[model samples]
Target: MPDKPRVILDSKQLELTINRLCYQLIENHDDFANSAIVGLQPRGVYVSKRIHEELAKMTGNKNIRHGALDATFFRDDFRTRETPRIPDVTELNFNVENLKVILVDDVLFTGRSVRASMDALLAFGRPQLVELLVLIDRRYTRHLPIMPNYTGKMVNTSLSERVSVEWKETEGKDCVKLHTVKK
Candidate 1:
């Protein structure tokens, strides 16, 4: 039999986490006039979009600007990987110049993605600040010194374990899980 996945957050918990995250974001960025929410592609896009929608609904501001960023080319391991990776769609219409940018993603692993995201974001105008938001913070796995400014959950796992986040946009349900191979 295959290794069973351990549930970290169920649908209810996921919703609550999202709502809490939205509230914390509002607490930090009231009205969000000087802030921009950018989601990392392709999995991070779901969390980013969810945050954008919830934050807009919470604040009743339809003009909350949200964008999607792809970090395929900016990744340090892209060229070194055996298989070639395809770039995803990047859709950021608004400029990030001098604005506080919140980078949203599903999980924070080795911190390489966040580093790559910073490089990718620099293609656009420079932002006054950039903060990271992740649904799951995998602690003690940082290949680089990166931490999430806003996190839904923090978990400690061994190197052999993997953390997976699923969303309704892609997985038809929202949940977080830890997966480990059966020895």
Candidate 2:
């Protein structure tokens, strides 16, 4: 039997975590003048939009560069998938060369998506620096060398368990949950 879904970060806690991440980003980027924020497409766009909005409100600069990137076509497993996956739109309209690029995503699992996102970014330009920021980092599950530079939360779980992040815009709520799948 599958176990009941466990709430990892509730709405209030998720907000707090996001706030902390914003502060950390501010501390490092300092006004984001030479930095670009790129949110991964599909689910990651929500978290990236929130972070971009918060950064604007906190820095008093609404002109910060923000875009969404879709890495579907660049994924290594794209050809192996049973169903044909549709590619999402890539919204990056600015150059990334010589700039600090921060990649935002909702979850960091096997690191395959992060790797794919990096490949997808090549069409824009080579960034001087690329950092990853994720809402949830599923520890000990990485299949690649990728790691999150800033993580909202670190969770430990078995390989069969799945983590899901819900946002107000998508699921009508903001929360992180872990589900046990019976294989």
lDDT for each candidate structure: 0.92, 0.93
**What tens-digit string does per-residue lDDT give for candidate 2 at 50-78?**
99999998999998999999998889986
What TM-score do all the candidates reach, one by one?
0.96, 0.96
**How much does candidate 2 score in TM-score?**
0.96
Q: Using alpha carbons, what is the TM-score of model 1?
A: 0.96
Model 1 local distance difference test score: 0.92
State each candidate's clash count. 0, 0
Q: At residue 143, what lDDT does model 2 achieve?
A: 96
RMSD of 1: 1.1
Q: Which regions of candidate 1 are displaced past 4 Å? A: none
Highest lDDT: give the candidate number.
2
Which pairs of residues clash in candidate 1, taking residues 3 or more apart in a chain or in different chains? none
